[model samples]
Target chain A: MSMTHWQAAFAARIARDEPQWLAPMRAAAMTSFNALGFPTTALEDWNYTSLSSIAEVPFTVGASASSTTVADLTPYMINAEWPTIVLLNGSYSPSLSSLDSIPAGMLVMDLAQATREQPALMQQHFGTVATSEHAMTSMNTGLMQDGVFVHVPKHVESETPIHILHVSDAAAAMSAKFPRTLIVAEAFAKATVLESFVGMADVAYFTNHVAEVVVGEHATITHTKIQRESDLATHVSTTEVHQARNSHYVNFSMAMGSKLSRTNVYTVLDGDGGGVTLNGLYLGKGTQHTDHQTRIEHAQPNCFSRELYKGVLDDASHAVFNGKVYVHPIAQKTDGKQSNHTLLLSPDARIDTKPQLEIFADDVRCTHGATVGRMDEAGLFYMKSRGVPAETARRLLTYAFAADVLETIENETVKQALEQLTLERYAGSGNNTAHAAREH
Target chain B: MLEISNLTATAGEKDILKGINLTVNAGEVHAIMGPNGSGKSTLAQVLAGHPSYEVTGGTVHFEGEDLLELEPEERAHKGVFLAFQYPIEIPGVSNAYFLRSAYNAMRVARGGEEVDPMEFLDVMEEKLKIVEMDDAMLARSVNMGFSGGEKKRNEILQMAVLEPKLAILDETDSGLDIDALRVVAEGVNKLRRPDNAAIVVTHYQRLLNYIIPDFVHVLAGGRIIRSGGKELALELEEKGYDWLLQEALA
Candidate 1:
């Protein structure tokens, strides 16, 4: 479909129900989306990823929330008691959400309802950080109807994490869903936000998600996203963050499923003494293509940033990782480190990794490295010499290749769950496997 | 218990072992001492299947089974072990996990039930004592960040657990101090049985003072040039390999 077709379809189908305050922003977003169009290989930022497959499909927009019971969500829930927000097909489902236990000062509700109740908050942050400068994010901003809106008040220190579960149960093929999420943590507050994008059925669809995070001064926040979409789906998500002074933010992204998936995370340390860590692990098999593009901007002095992204590719799958760390001229005393490592399991698997560092500061410590290689043969032989079968040895090493990233997760329950998922994905099935042999 | 007939192997285009012949019987410790470039480590690695060396011509029989026809792990299951000179470091896999996996694999190969962590821990505790190592080593990644002595001791600990019938020690004493060498030698000694044999390949005879070998052979230019009893090692230690090389040429 062409850009005009998308704009015309959006106006005909979605313009009737929006409030008057959002109409101008939506129109401006539509104009931006039209100007940017869909990113192609011509763009440097998207050199390795192609959107032809997605652009060829005439995906119908405005898919309604699918009807699902609490039982359907059993397999995806990390914890049963944590406050949950469910977004089915692009729209929020109140019946499936359980926010009754949320703290008194915390606000967790659907984005559309939050827009009505907290219009000032929505207008202030909705499209501010994740502006309409990019194509997919711009399109999402133009068409987004419902998503998640979370606000943790000053000094709230929410112990229980908020889970945003995005489920795509498309009634028909070629369905498209646009879900947005806005998280705001006030000063001295602490919170963890987990977003899971899961496709219930094996059907062709498209999911364009946009999330914006605001970490106040002296606050700490952890944001994790686990994407397990359908093998036939196309998933593109962008997360933009702004950090205040002395704030700490950690973002963990794991991409396990989808035919074509592109994940972009852009974080700017806008205040002095702030720190940020972006860690990601992507597993690809079959003909899947997983791409991760991250950019961290040190806009202030004395900021610290660390990033480690690793990919495990098997079969004929392909993975791409491009990490860029920019230190502005005024951002002196910056300490930044970035690394991208890939492990190719099969001979046919391929990975393209690049670590781009741009430092304009005269006094700064910055380092970046990228490595693309196969499993260690010497290590394999050592294991085999100890009586481990070749197949089992390979699995163990592959699992170990991805285990270090899981070690950086602070949430114990989520870390264990993600570890188990990683082990199962790479280790396959066997008696006395790594999962069974785990110590504590 | 083990026999090698006319064994010839090459690493890449360079021949490392040429027309070597040896036999090891049960209850015997044979020491193959040689100078540098004498294929001592190559011979040991070939016996345990290092995969880097290509055996062009050889017939190795371990207890009447074709040892060369099996994979490394199969050879391991058939009671063959190689204590590496430079043990490879495997990160992210705990030492206890690797030990239990190897132990269970050997057990299952022998048609025995696998042991649980509790039972495995008990067995590990005993083996750690054999090597004079503490239990702290078991929680670390396999051989990762271990000192030289710690790595060698970990190898000996594995030897104690696997209990292979034919253990090949490839320069196992090269990087050990006096205390570590004695502990390693004692570990090997305690694991010895009348039904098992060992091939200790070394350049120096310092290690033979602790673990005495029944037979000592001098390997030069990929061939065993001389053979004698335990006293031959002491003579080589005193006289060096030059006199033996001249005698072999004459």
Candidate 2:
């Protein structure tokens, strides 16, 4: 697991005349990645998720290839009309992506290209928010080849959302892919971006991803990450957000796939009147495992944050939610609320939820709560008394439980689409026709 | 259409209904007036097959079949409806959805096809007007944020839509205003048919004014101590249950 061997080899293989500042940052990150191996259950954050399944993955860094075609990558694209960036095996696939209609003065390109073409701009903001501290993050920073870099200048807004799709088409049993995304919204600017991680094959691969979002004063940003990898793939991603004075930031993460997936979302309200809202929904079935570890820090006065996460566990699948909110000494008038609720359909399925709040300021108002239970018996009885079969009753109740979270999405079309997908996911659980008939 | 024989039931270690015997023919409305904890609700719950109460010795025949042998849902499917006194609040379930499910459940139990949403909505639109309830309540969650009067009216709406053979109103007039009470009573009176019956359980005679009863019975302790025509309700309202309890004891 030493980095000395791979650092020299990676440097020799990459093209010459690359940005000078990136090499040392990558070298230092590789050192940190080597020092800290994969986290284990002994750590409180990783207690419920078992990383031993991915410990022995035979992973090797992949090289860029030009033969990748858009037809091969069409299944993973969510929005075809928006400016698109496609990354294959952690390398930019120029032939498969298009960015024709981007507004003027907005910078949207591969981070690797941004580093080579505009070194000064890349040096000012790259790695500014996501530090190389944890092993997965450090590995992403160390071995990162190509990702998205989006910059919206002051007072500018984009009409359409930027779409970035990351596909892992690796053939090796233990191949590794590292993807990084860096976005900066200047003062009074607005933008929406969606990042999707998908796997084209069912091979056992590992994807380590890191994204950094910085919102300036009076700015607003909405970012969404959708993870739908292969059944045998392991995904670990961290999204760090820093909100400045009077700025608003919203991040949504949906985990529907991956054998062992964990997402860490960290938000910091760094200035006065700043607000951030974090929302997530994870649907796990079969033997899949999903974990969401979220932390929100209120560092200044008049800041607010709300976190709502929900999960539905079926079969023998397991879900974990560890959400923490911190109110610092000067962060008064901070209205923070966190709630995590889960439904365990099968007796064997499990969910571990903990909502933590630490407040040092006496003038702040913060609340946190968590609930884990089966379908409401009274509710089921009431529905059954009406003529709904027991199975349909269960499905309706389950969908309603998740709908409480889906209704929070601000976009009408996205909210409706996600709600339909949520219902379909429940309907796919061996009660399709019954649920479909009930819906009508 | 309904018969009870030796109906003995208990909640925990205390007996609530002791060997209660009564019978109701079709097209009759019977009123049961009792003091607090005199087993008025116990009779309604036991008849509805609530799992909390244990039936030590009882036999209920509804439409010539053993009613106590069936589950609560089965009892409901067999045309036995209990309008709760304190209706349970079900969050996240729409009122329309709840009523449609109940209506379809009863229909399917009788070997009929289930109604589609559009047809069910048409039926709800017609029945909701009977209770003077707005269409908004039907779209909202069942009893989640409804006022007391709204909840009771919603119950009557369910009764109108389901049209059960035996409708048991267990203290449905407790928290209703005068207008809500009149609307609910009118809804119930409209649903009455020669082939259906009702058992109105209450502690006062106020509700009987809106929907006149054919018979009134005084339930003291666990058994009916007196039975008379509708005038008994007016008499009880004038003298109260204490005088009747004293008369029964004497």
Candidate 3:
């Protein structure tokens, strides 16, 4: 029989001598990944996105990438005082990172080190939070060579945010990179992680990323992910979170550049009185397509979740947002809300939004809605009649649409970075409607 | 310094204003009073170059220049202001930002220096006092969630800030209480200069009590039926608009 596409990639990995126990788990994960394959449009969960373009290319599995420095990551790096873990082509880079300032009682190391040093801990919690329902998660478990792992002990709080940066240096075109991150916070511990994924502007690559978080009782975790890959690159990222009793979880994500990118966030509130907040912003221009999908599961009583996602599309770009919230029967006092808003700046730009709410419990308060709007003509006229120039009005209105959601971000530095990037996007697309009107 | 000769306009092929003639020099406030459906607001809208109103026949001249040829914003840059009856609400744009943008845009068109935010805030605070507005209103979105009186006062505040040559108020007193009417009329009276003129369009004569008009013109059935002194508004208030409608029909 002819071997499948993933089989060859798997064969190349087991060729080297690896950890002893990983052999059986890798075998099982490979079997599941081959069965699942790539999700297609026939599946209702991925109806708006198609993987045909991704499935066509023959991808090379990456081991080592070209040499890069901190200079290549300055654009996407936040200006702050924190310990950062830098990864080049999905592998750890000790030279390009700063680990001297990490706080005490925290275990911040690569997966390989965790597997060797804390063998029992790695055996206990490696795949506990990362699910294997789909191919991407299982594929990462089977073939992921090196990734990031962070653990915060009980009753400790770190003020400085731990930054995990993944910079893709595609030494060879058509190479594929798989990045996995696992974070475990014990009871009453608090930590914040800022994770970013970026690459060169014109490079072509495939990035499959997954992050899983295990939040314990009364523990707090704030995870922010920023995906800004090259326009010729493809990115598929998934985030999974499981919260304990009375724990708190906040997730913020922004998708800026990619030919075809999808960001999926799934959360399960397994304990009572826990809270979840999810906020996202996606910007697409040119022929880029950005998708944001979120699912919040309320399995316990007295839990609450809030989700708001907004998108802006210009040129011939497209965007999609599908958010679902499910409240079980035992979760009677659950409170959940989800809102999706999109603004199309061109006639050819489009968006598809599906907001779903599934509640089996009575006496629960849940609200879900989606809205789509083009530029407001009356608002433009009001600005024009007030003597504001046409182009200025257009830029201001466009900025205001995205700024409304960006203002909700609690991190001041992160908010400013995103705002600058958004302004650059608007300035780059100078042929937008307002400019067209001015030309006429 | 404004002239309208044989001015006619239509909306969707239906004539709304037919054969209107008026003249106003500088240093005057002219009140055009009429009953409902008498096309009182249409004249103010047409003069400001609203796109919905097509000028079928006639000419409007401001400072001896054809005003109809200029865009609405161009007319605004040349010192023409219209206080809308119902101001539109724009969310996510702060009141201070919108005001400064308008001020700077006009200044750029006039080849004058633009005011910085600190300097503009000083100017805005002074104008807000003229319109009896609070400082906190400047931080909120433009006209979003504002009460009826606050919106009207905001319009007057804008008019006060722009300091236009010819200001038109369309039914500015319809939804106002006595206090707001007094504040708005006081603000208007303060803006009058020997070089600028005003046009007040109202359905009632009560607003004339605060700011007296130089001339009272009664309009009926798309035409100005009569013109008199300030006593004309008083006479219409004492009686009703029936006399003017009858006189014009005859």
DockQ of each: 0.65, 0.32, 0.40
Model 3, position A15: C-alpha lDDT score: 85
TM-score of candidate 3's A chain against the true A chain = 0.93
Q: Measured by TM-score, how close is model 2 to the native structure?
A: 0.90
Is candidate 1 or 2 superior in DockQ?
1
What is the TM-score of each candidate's chain B when compared with the real chain B?
0.99, 0.98, 0.98
TM-score of each: 0.97, 0.90, 0.92
User: Poorest 10 consecutive residues of model 3 chain A by lDDT?
Assistant: A431-440
lDDT of 3 at B77: 90
Calculate the i-RMS of every candidate, to one decimal place: 1.6, 3.6, 7.7
Task: List model 1 lDDT by residue over A110-179, tens digit each.
Answer: 9878878998888878777886378999888887868899998899897678999998775625788889
Better of 2 and 3 by lDDT: 3
Give the alpha carbon lDDT tens digit for every residue of A26-47 in model 2. Answer: 7787778778767778877788
The candidates score, on chain A by TM-score, as follows 0.96, 0.92, 0.93
Give lDDT: candidate 2, residue A292.
Answer: 97
